[model samples]
Target: MAEYEAKFTELSGFVPEFVNTEEKKARRFQLATKSFISRNFSNKLNLNVVPLREVLQVEIANREIIPVNQVHHRCKLKLEGKAFEVDLIPFVLGKFNMVIEMDWLSSNGVQIDCKKKKVRIRVQDGKEIMFKGQRKTHKFLTMFQTKNLLKKGNESYLAYVMDTKKEIPDIQDIPVVNEFEDVFPKDLPGFPPDREI
Candidate 1:
């Protein structure tokens, strides 16, 4: 587990997420959690997501199958302090947030020290950024397998109280909209003349 801070324009900021590195994975493509994407990336304009025609099936630790059909291209990921552009497929990883395959690591000159629990990345400037791995701790909430529990005749329901008075950020303050100011004009013209395609 080579956890690090990842930044994304869609996310609108940096987030601490667990990144799993698998050397034996045959595929080179990386994966990001669907929950992570939905939770952080509320603005679609900043996301370069594409739906795949053919869904890919992946088996996790418990042999549960997860179908993947979306890919986020050229996503900006800031690991440690160095930035990187990567393609990530949306996945259902339970507790993990992302997966860093071996191909990407090898190509990017990333070295992992298992004994030291550190990940070293060599950047373009020949400088190395080191990320220390966090020790795994069992959290009661995270340990619950909802799907499995439900399969065993257990019941589950989402319970939440809505906060209707939550303050919404001003349109001008939105980073994504600000980036494309031309697209989202502060004031739209009265009307446009009807034109034929």
Candidate 2:
């Protein structure tokens, strides 16, 4: 195998700088439940699937964020028992209102259509329930089928998987999955450009 030299360069781009501060504008975080997992291991409830046979009208603690200042807050759902952490990531979905999204580690995550003020989610074993457009997508970003939301329902229900959607949000890089290291690669060797071609 021929050895190859690696070199990297950036053509140019714009990055948001707050108050002329030289800080990376974004970070990633996560919320998982050891409690939710126990139910799957214990003597009865199968954690592999969330029982959605009769459960509907899911109560969620909505979250929202301000992009300019990069601030976040919960919807003040002072529910007694089981406090859930909602992820408020910055996204360019038309306006800045695409702030609060997805409840962490739930059977199905939540995505709110800011303009519609309606929530999008998925069920464990349930099918997709329509809400509006003639073309609707799947539950979450996983193995499931997609459909259209031609009708309106008070609370839309779905199965967990973003089976289809031509414009699904790119979310793979926003969540943390391993150890956190503060340092970045700054000492990588560069390759010389070939000038004798």
Q: Count clashing residue pairs per candidate.
A: 0, 6
lDDT of every model, 2 decimals: 0.64, 0.32
Residue 59 C-alpha lDDT in model 2: 16
TM-score of each: 0.47, 0.20
Cα deviation in Å at residue 118, candidate 2?
Answer: 11
Compare the candidates by TM-score and give the number of the best one: 1
Question: Model 1 over residues 34-105: C-alpha lDDT tens digits?
Answer: 222331442443676788777766656664557778778777788776789766666554555566666678
Cα misplacement distance, residue 85 of candidate 1 (Å): 1.1
Estimate candidate 2's RMSD in Å. 29.7
